[model samples]
Target chain A: MYKIESKEVSLYYGDHLALKNISLQMKANTVTALIGPSGCGKSTYLRLLNRMNDLIENVKIEGTVLIDNKDIYARGIKIDDLRKKVGMVFQKPNPFPKTIFENVAYGLRVNGISNKSYIEERVIRSLQNSALWEEVKDKLNKSAFELSGGQQQRLCIARALAIEPSIILMDEPASALDPISTAKIEELIYELKDKYTIVIVTHNMQQAARVSDRTAFFYIGELIEYNDTKEIFTNPQNQRTQNYITGRFG
Target chain B: MKKIFSRLLNHLITVLLYISGSITSLIVILIVFFLFSEGIGLFGKKPTEDGFIMAVNKSNTVNHLNAEQIKLLFDGEITNWSEFGGKNDSIILFRMDNITDYFTEEQIGENFENLPACISKVVDSIPGIVAFVGKHYIDKNFAGKELQVDKITVGDFMFGKLWFPTAHPVAVFGALPLLLGTFWVSIFAILFALPLGLATAIYIAEVAHPTVRNILKPVIELLAGIPSVVYGFFGLVVVVPFIQNAFNLPVGETAFAGSIILGIMALPTIITISEDAIRTTPRSMKEASLALGANHWQTIFRVILPYSSSGITAGAILGIGRAIGETMAVLMVTGNAAVIPHTLLAPVRTIPATIAAELGEASQGGLHYQSLFILGCVLFIITMIVNLAVEFISRRNRRVAS
Candidate 1:
């Protein structure tokens, strides 16, 4: 059964349309990667699931998005509830200007769960899951800024995890990190899929191929191909997918 | 030839630019130099008017009187000479203008030609008499003992409790009351402006739609451009009555009213800078917050405010700079009272207001005029310190944001 689905989704940013009608589905506890060049609507499509596009000015979204088979765009849908179930990691290691413990506990605090032990347990678990636990365990009260670049990115991931969302969205999460940090994040994504459905947008085809179980190639606001990661990278059926994956053209 | 012409034009432009910049700096330096030099001159000089002396009856053992004691003695606030450790006698004050009361006009003679003898007789007979007379009035054989009060000192000028710069015989030039009044008004102005301005900034940066923000931001900024006198006028006409009615105070032109006006004046600075700062919260951070199920307000309170804390601090200090240096608005509404303000509801006078109200009436090169300049010096130092604080906060703001 599909954990998340978009039926004929189209998005417009004022006069210009950013995403064309695109249908995609992802199974529960699986990693899906969106590979595209700049301005290719991959990020736009990823933003649609959590309704992140609503924050932009003059954004007009059409069609239905389903998470856990519930239409999120329907009337009476609470954004807070929808967002709580959908976590996102950004391109930059954008941790809150807070301590590591507070940054992880931020989700619990915002969601109004104030039991101290529960928060501590959840924060420690999230940090451990993001593979940043041992490195920062002794200094959880220190500022998140004191961490190295790779550790900060993992801390952000840990922050998202503390929300306990079933679906996590990664928008070029490893784009700003060093090679070793990229490897660690790719490794973390592989581990995250056993408990959370994951969707990621990336410019790097190899990273996408390594981390994602399913791959969707998008170009100029249209989904060109959607298939198993191996098939998309090794046996792409579309011309543009072939060109993008093999570096013929972006 | 064209290259040579362009080079010559470039040289001319450089020279012109250099000259204009130097001219501007030179003018500012000259003004500042004049203010400090003249202001500092108030010290080491007697607070009394030049060529003026006070005379006590030869029998009266009052050796010297300072500005405050003389003012009190003349004003009838002090009824007996014993207040200054003199003999327990009711004080009898005499002035040049009171010659008729001391003696009949005919007895002093037609064009006051016998005024000298009459004054001498009055001073000699009135044992408790303290006469404030010019040197021209005293003859060679005057019976009264002339006394010179101690010169004003910087310590007295800064820490003295009285602020009677125009008091006769000698003027008290205590700066304490004016300093406290400025401090009191500015602190309250900040208390009024900071939170309100920060809320408006948050609305503009975080909550308002683009069209609303565009309109609201400029309009709030335009509040700063409105002349401070207009704010003073508004304070006097509207805010004063409103406060007076609300608090049931006897008068409305008070420190409270001055603070309200100054806070209004400061709003534009705080709002504009704070909004700019609030707007600088990285989009990535905001997205991250929202993605974690944080509401808009939560995102704002938890992420944006903390992220831009330093910048908001800079804005607040700059707003304080505006409130501290503001003159006309505070002047028109603060009742111009030169007493130490003990409460916000009371009438008070800030430094700039004191200078503006008194500068016109103060005679040039006198103690009053120079004290006003020193007030300017104090104001300059305060604003300079505020600006420096802003610089420091802004630097920290940048470092944190990155």
Candidate 2:
């Protein structure tokens, strides 16, 4: 059974259609990568999984987005609960202007967790999972801004992980990072799929091939192809996907 | 020809911008120098050896005097007249009345203008004695002997306890309470304005839709441009009555009332600066919070408010400086009483208001006159401190942002 599914979903920004009749399924505990050029509705489609599009004004979404067989857009669905289940990391690292410990513990604190032992344990576990604990454990009380860019990105990932979401959404999460930082994030993504269903939107084809289990190609707001990452990279399926991957055209 | 025209235009623009920037600094320096030099004159020592102490009245008449035969008449000494050659007359002392012109007809009397007539009247009314009065009140209609006028030595004036420096014993202008009152009122005004103003800024910057923000932002900004006198009038008419009625007081003029009005006046500055700061918080921060399952209130409080805290603090200090420096509005609403504030509801006098109310009629070189200048200097120092604090906070905020 699929962990998350989107059926015939379309989205609009006022009168302009942004996504047209998208459909896909993501399996549990696997990494799925969405690759597309800018403004191809790839990010827009990923945002719908957690109802993040609700924050934008005049954004009209159609059809249903389901997670764990529950319609996330249904009337009784709480945005906060949906977001908790599906955590998101942005392209740029945005650690809170707080201590390293507080940055990772922010979500827990916001959820009204008062037990210090529980928060401390969860923060350590999350940091260890994101592979940033060793480098920053000594400076947990230092401001998050004190960390370098690469460490800040990892800290953001640790912050998201501390919430214990079943699914992690990465919206071009490594795009703004340097080569070394990007490699570290890709490695972290590969490790993350063991415990969380991951959906990443990336323009880097090599990164998608390296880290993702399944790959979906989007063009002009339409889903061009979705298949196993190996198959998509090796076999002839869609001309547009081939062209985008082969560097002929975007 | 074209090259020359453009060059000429460039030079003209540069000159205009430079003049605009330098005008305020130059004027401020001149004003400070003027106040300092003139204020320092109150402490100038006189060379004259002969001296006699004289008492004056509100009528501007000189009626009694200490004979020049005496070595000296120090301040707080000679409370009675028998010591000064008068027949056991209690020396009636008159204050400067916080009026700017010590020699003004309203301050002295509508009828009397010189010391001699005042002395004649004093002698006729109080029997035989000597008194020092305003120079404007001097004439030969009085019967009492005119004592020699004692020049106010600089040393005596500075250390003098009382502020009666008119024509005889130069009054010492006490600045301790007036300065304290100013600080208290301004501090209270900032305390009142900071939170309310920042909340309004957050609502406009982060929460309001375009339409609501457009409508409310200008209205708040317009408050900063309103003439302070108009605010004073509003405080006088509306706020004073409201406070008086609500508090069951005899009058409405009070420190609390002044703080409220000044707070309202300062709202535009605080809101504008803080809103700009909140607006400039990186959008990525907002996205980060939202992605963490944090609710709108949580994100606003945790991220937006903390990020903009320094700017909000800057706005608050600027607002406080404005409140402390305000003159007309405070004078109208604060009851202009130069006493230390015991409660928010009590009437209070701020430094700027005290200076404004008293500088108009105070003697040009008298202690009362120079003390007002000193008050101006105090205000200048306070505003400079506030600006410096703002700079420090801004630099720290910039470092954090980077």
Candidate 3:
């Protein structure tokens, strides 16, 4: 069974249609990378799975987003439950102006986990899993802002991981980082897929090829191609995908 | 040629900017200097009216008396000189009007030329006489000795409880009542405004629909523009009566009424600034909190409120600045009684109210006028401290953001 599925989903921001009927399926423990140039609706599509698009006013959505065969957009859905199951990391390293420990512990605490030792263990495990444990362990009480850009991004990842979400969605997470940090995040994403089903939106085609098991190429508002990363990179599924991957045109 | 012209224009603008800046600073300095210079003159003048001298017999041991002591003695409150550490004697009050009792007008010349000698004789005969007379009335042949009345000291002016600047025999200029009044009213105003303002700001900035926010934003801003006198009027008719009825007080124009008026007056500042601060919290921060599965209220409490804490503090301080300096409404609503405030229910007077109430009646450049200037200086210093605190808080907030 697919871990996550979207069935003919379309979204409109007021009168302007932002995403067309896009359907995709992902298996458990697989990394799916959504690749496109700017304004390709890739990030918008990523946000739809976790219902983050609901934050915008006058946003109307159609069709169904299914996790474990349950439609999230249906009536009587507690959005908190949907969000807790699907964690999201953004393009920039957005950390709360709190201590490093608190940043990681935020999700657990907000979700009503009040056991101090349990929170501490989860924070440590999340930090260790995100590969930021040793560098930040000594300064857990320090502010998250004191971390460098790369470390801050990892801190955000640790924050997302601490919630123990079954699915993690990253929107251009490394676009704001340096090349070294980008490599580190790519490696972290590869490690993360062993536990959480991961979907990442990236502007870099090489990044998509290197980290993703399968790739979906979106153009304008449509998914131009959806295939295994290796096949999508090497084979010509569509002329537009060819152009974007080769830097022929955006 | 164009480059040279542009350079010349730049230089002209630079000179203009420099001149404007210097003029503003100079004006501020001169105003402050003017206030202090005039205010400091109050120290030079004695608390007694000009040419009024308190005299005693040459054999009397009392050589000095303060204004309060002299007032008590003349009011017949102090019956004996021993209370003031002088030789034990019953106090006798003497005024210039009592001269006829000592001698017939015909014994003095028709022109009253021999009145000085008679005054001398009266003072000489009465050893315990404490006489209030004009300084010019004492001549070289006068037998009475003048008791020294000390000039008003800064300590007396600051800590003195009485504030009767226009008292006929001697005007007292104690500022403690006015200071505490301003202090109590401001504290109560902020205490009322901060929580109320912050809650309204949160609703407007974070929770309200755009339509509701649009309607509320300008209305609250308009609340700020409404003059204090109008608010004072509202308090006078509505709030004062309500308070009077509710508390069963004798008068409505108590400090509580003043506080209500000031709190109402200070609300717009607190709300508008707090809303702006709450709105300035990065959208991404809210997103981060929401994405963590925290509800909207949680996001507001945990993320938005904490993020805007310093800005809210700056707003509260600025609101206090407004409350402390407010005159008209406070004057109208607070029963204008110059007494140290012990309770919020008591009628109190603030420094600004005292100045506004007395400036016209106080003859300019006189002791009373200069005393008003000193009040202005105190108000100025309080306002300056509040503004500096706001500046320091905002600067630190900016540093943290950067």
Candidate 4:
């Protein structure tokens, strides 16, 4: 069974239709990269998985988004619980103005997990999983703002992981970082898929080829193609997919 | 040629700008200088060319009297000389108006041109009389003796508990009660306004629908634009009577009434500033909080409020500054009783109210007039400190944000 599925989901921001009827399915423990040029609605599509679009005003959605065979958009599905199951990292490294330890611990605390020992154990495990523990462990009580951009991004990932979300959505998570940091994030993403289902939105084709198990190409408001990353990179599926992969046009 | 013309125009503009800036600075310096020069006189003995003095017949036993005693004598609370350590005679009151009553119209002249002479004649003739008139009218050649008056000291002006500036013999310039009242009303005002203002700001910035925000924003601004006198009238008609009935006080005019009125007056400032600060919190930060599965209230409390804490503090400080300096509404509602208030229910007077109420009648260049200016100086310093604190807090906020 698919771990996550969106069936003919359409999204409208006020009168402007941002996403057309786009259907996709993802298995557990796989990395799927949503690749497209700017303003192609890839980020908007990613946000819809966890209902982050609900934050915007006058947003309308049609059809269903299912996680673990249960429709998230259906009545009686609490949004906070859905969000706990689907974590997100933003385009920029946005850390809360708090201690590094507290930034990671925030998720567990907010979820009403009161066992301090359990929280401390989870925070350490999440930081180690994000590969930021060794660098930040010495200054766990220090402010998250004092970290380098790459470290801050890792801390954000650690924050997402601390909640133990089943699905992680990353929206250009390394776009604001240096190339070294981007590489680290890419490496971490490769390691992350063994434990979590990951969807990453990126404009970089090479990054998609280097990390994703499957690559989904989005154009305008439609998903043009979805196939094995190797096939999409080396072989032809659709003309638009080939063109975008080969840098013919956006 | 065009290049030279443009360069010359640029230089002229720069020069003009410098001149305008200097002129504003110069004017501010001059005003501050003038205020300090005149106000400093209140702290110590300063010779005056002429001031109103209490004089009596040479035979009167009272050698000197303090301001409170003189006030009692004039107010009819003290009717005899024995009440004020004087001869056992009836304390006859003489004023400029009674000059005509004492002498014939022909002797006094049509316009009271002989008023000084008539005053001297009355003082010399009436043994029990105490006369209050301008010092120039106290003829040295006449038998009426000018009672030596005590000068108001800075210690008395700053620390004295009573504020009776109109008291005779020597007007008391004590500002402590006014100071306490000002702070008392302002503290209550801040306590009343801060939470309401902050909550309204958060609602407008985070929770309110667009239509609700648009309507409420202008309504709050309109509240600020209403004349202070109108607010005073509202306080007098509404809040004062309510407090009186609720607390079973004899009079409605109390510090609480002034606080309510001032709190209402300070709301717009606090709301507008705090809302702007909350709105300026980065969209990405809020999104990050929400994306972390934190609910809306959690995001607002844990993230948005902390991030905008400095701005909110600055807003509260600005509100407090407004409350402290407010005059007309406080004067109208605070009962203007120049005594130290022990509770919110008591009638009180603030420094600004005292200055506003008496500056008109304080006789320019007199100690009372100078003392009012000193009150203004105190108010200026208080506001300056508050503003400086606001600047420091915002700067620190910026540093943390960066």
Candidate 5:
């Protein structure tokens, strides 16, 4: 069974159709990268998995979104519970105006895990998983704003991991950071796929080639192609995908 | 040539602007100088021409008595002339009135027609006689000598508990009661307004539907635009009667009535400022909280409210400044009793109300007039401090946000 599936999903913002009928599935413990040019509905497709699109006004979704073979869009499903099982990081590093330790520990506290030792352990382990533990362990009480832009993004990743969700969604998570920080995040994503099903949206074609095992290219609200990263990069089955990857045309 | 003309015009405009700005600054400086110069004069000793003079029989050894001795002697607390290095004779007090224990209206004639003659006769007949009369009533040819009075002191003006601005011997300038009343009403007004204003702000900013917010915002702003006297009239007609009927008091006007009116007046300011603060929180921050599996209420309390805490505090301080400087509504509803109120139900007078009520009746260049200016100075300082506090808090919030 697939770990996550979107069966013929379509979405609309007011009268403007943002995403067309799209079907995709991901196996357990695999990294999937969605790549496209700007306003191509790649980020919108990623947001559909965790229902983050619900926060926007005039949003309409049609079709089934399932995780662990259960329909997330079905009635009687709690949105908060669905969100707890699928953690998301934004394009920008938006940390709460709080200390670094508190930023990481917020998810656990909100989930009603009151044990002090458990929260402390989870925060530290999540920091270590994001490779930010050694740099921040000595000053966890300092404000999250004191960190550089790259460190703040990694801290946000650590915040997502503290909840221990089975699926993690990243929307251009490293697009705002420098090259060195982008490589660090790519390396961290490579390690994270061993335990969590990771889906990342990227604008950089090279980034999708470096970090993803499977790749899907979307164009004008339609999924143009999906295949193994090596196959899509080496041998193209679609003309548009070839044109995009070769930097000929978006 | 046109370019040169435009440049010359620009220079002339600059000069005009400078002159206008300097004129405004100069006027402000001159007002401050005038207010301080006149206000500070209240603390010094100056002989006022309108006070009562104490006259003796000329044989009495006491030539001058201090303010306290005069007060005590007139209050009937001192009955023996021997207390002041005089002959050990029984003291006979004389006052300008229709009837007294020492003399009757018949003996002094109807309407006290021969008041000056009667006073001269009384002083010449009794060696220990001490008479109190207006300075204009004292006859210079009589066999009595006028005793010199001492000047009023700053300590007496500030700390004296009584507030009778038209009292005999001297008009008391004691300001403790008015100051306390101002603070008392303002504190109660804040206590009444803060919770209501903050809740309305949160609802409008976070919980209300868009259509509801659009309607509610303008209605609240309309509350601010209503004239203060209209509020005073509402307080007098509605709130005053309601309080009196509910508590069964003899009079309808009380400090509680004033607090209710001022609280209503301050709500718009508090609500508008706090709502703006809450709405300015970045959308991404809110999304981050919600996406972390936190509910909307949790996100508001944990993230939105904490981020906007300084703005809310500034709003509250500004509300308090509005309540403290309010005059006409307080003057109309607080019963205008110049006494230190011991309870919310008691009649009281605030400083602004006192200045507004009595400044008209106060004689120009007199002690009462100068004291009113001093009250204005106190109000200016209080408002300035509150505004500075608001500036400090908002600046600190900006730094933290950055």
Candidate 6:
């Protein structure tokens, strides 16, 4: 089933064109990696999925972004509820100052879920799915800041998962972490494909190659290539994609 | 040679700075030493039995009377000079003011034996009156006039409801109510200022934009630089009447008025310090909370406020110190009444105000004068406790933060 689709979408920050016309479809139970150099609109495109750009004043966008065949930016749509369904992990681990358990339970609390047992179960399950349960279960009540960088990143993932979002967006999630933590994140992304549709933005070509079934390459705010990961990496139709894959120039 | 000369010049500058600093410190230490030397003398055990005594000077007249004859004359028992079998004369009442330049300690004869001789002569010469004499002069006799009384009673000394220090039994001040009133007014001033000041700080720190903050911050800080007497005048004219009319009271010069004025005056110090602290909260922490879906208010309450609480508390303590040490504003608005104020609406007196009002008229070594020194000691102790508390709490907070 189609989880999210954007058609002829363009994004602008005031007078500057941040994203050119683009069309894309994301399927359920699949991981799509969006790869580009810095300032090439990958993060902006990812933010568009949940309307994170709405936070910026004077941001303008054309065309429609649909989730499950429903236009997300349609009149009467609530941004809070949209955010509840579309979870996002930022470039850096941004955990609240609260304890790990409370951080995981924040979305649920905001949504007015008060059942302690259910919240506890969800929190544990999310941490387990994020592969952070064993490492942090002993110190769940400690402040999230007490954790290492990698542990904090996993804790943030667990926080997103605790809310049971169907579409998970990862924007350079492993960029701020070490190699071992990056591999762990890659493995977790592979594991999450069965339960959630995932879109990841990355500058690491190897990370994209290892974790995603399909890859989309962007350059200068325009989609340069979109195809199967193997095809795009091994036999690209575009000369820019080949140059980028072969490490000629960004 | 040039380098050596420049080095010598630098050394000279450093030496001069060091010497100046040392001299300043020495002057402060010497002033404290002097106050202690003069003040503690009153507490030392004197050989005389009485706390203080007064007698009439006998150099001006000859009165061949025994101690009983003089005692009877001063008791309002004998009204005329004939009671002492003297000429038919009305008893001459010789007080210190009526005496010669002896009060100024001018050289007398060949011996400057009695300083303040006029004070001594007034004490020794009265036939139908009483006067003041120093404790050191009790044994010195000139022309057969002797010091009459030993100790002044505590009741007659203080709260005789009268304050005539030149009288036979001078009023010794018992400062129970005045001390209590001082504490009450200071505490109320702190109470009035703390919340409003802290709230203003938070708004300036967290909520205001840069332009608004820049404008408001200096305005508030400028409030501190305004002369305190101006605040006193404003309080007397505006706050006093406002409080009076609001409460429908007979007069507006009450402790509440004093506290309100002091509280307003203290706001700049408290708000400036606390706002600076709040503004220093790390932007990373704020972003972290915001990214976790907490709004501005929640982030402020949960993160920024807790981190800045120590600074806010320090500012409050500073404001308390300011309020306790305030003189003019409180004196003008507090009605300067040395009574135990039972309610906020009643008139009150604080230590600084009492000292300012009473010190000029108080005789140098009288009990009332000493009482003001004791009040000074009390103010010093109160400020010391507040400083110590701020230090202790700030240390504890630093430990927890680390």
The candidate that achieves the highest TM-score relative to the unseen native structure? 3
> Lowest summed lDDT over 10 consecutive residues: which window, candidate 3 chain B?
B66-75
Report lDDT (CA) for all predictions: 0.90, 0.80, 0.91, 0.89, 0.88, 0.77
- Residue pairs that clash (backbone atoms under 3 angstroms), model 5: none
What DockQ does each candidate score versus the true complex, computed on alpha carbons? 0.74, 0.64, 0.70, 0.60, 0.65, 0.14
- Inter-residue clash pairs, candidate 4: none
Give the winner by DockQ. 1
Q: lDDT of model 4 at residue B368?
A: 78
lDDT of 1 by residue, B189-228 (tens): 9999999999999989888888998889779978878988
TM-scores of all predicted structures: 0.89, 0.83, 0.91, 0.84, 0.86, 0.70
User: On a 0 to 1 TM-score scale, where does candidate 5 land against the true structure?
Assistant: 0.86
Ranking 3 against 6 by lDDT, winner: 3
Best by lDDT: 3
**lDDT tens digits by residue: candidate 3, B51-162:** 8877898988888877667666777889998998988999998888888888998987899888778888999999888888887778998888889876788888888877
Ranking by TM-score: 3, 1, 5, 4, 2, 6
Return the number of clashes found in candidate 1: 0
If you assessed candidate 3 against the hidden native complex, which CAPRI class would it receive? Answer: medium
Model 2 chain A worst lDDT run, 10 consecutive residues? A235-244
Please provide, for model 2 over B1-402, each residue's C-alpha lDDT reduced to its tens digit, 9 standing for 90 to 100. 999999999999999999988998899889889977876664443322224334333332433322122223434356665665545556544323312222455545565444344445554554433354444444545454454444444334333333332323433344555666777778788888888998899899878999999999888878888999999999999999999999999889999889988889888889999999998988889888888899999999999889888988888888887887888899899997766578888898887887787788986765667756766776787788989999999999998888
- TM-score, structure 2 vs. true: 0.83
Q: After superposing candidate 3 on the true structure, give the runs of residues whose Cα lies further than 4 Å from its correct spot.
A: B1-26, B56-130, B137-146
Expressed as tens digits, the lDDT of each residue in B1-402 for candidate 6 is 999999999999999999999999999788666555554443322212245554434542434443234444555567666666654556654443544533443543335465445444554454444444445644544432554332433332233232322334333344566667777887888898888988898898877877899999889989999999999999999999999999999999999999898999889989998888788776655644444455567668777887778878888888888888999999899987776678999998887998899889977875556656756766777888989988987797676455
Residue pairs in steric clash, candidate 3? none
The DockQ-derived docking category for candidate 1 is medium
Candidate 6's DockQ: 0.14
**Tens digit of per-residue lDDT, candidate 5, span B19-117:** 999999999889888877777777765333455677889888888765556666767788888987778987777776622555767877776666677
Tell me the deviation in Å of residue B280 in model 5: 0.3
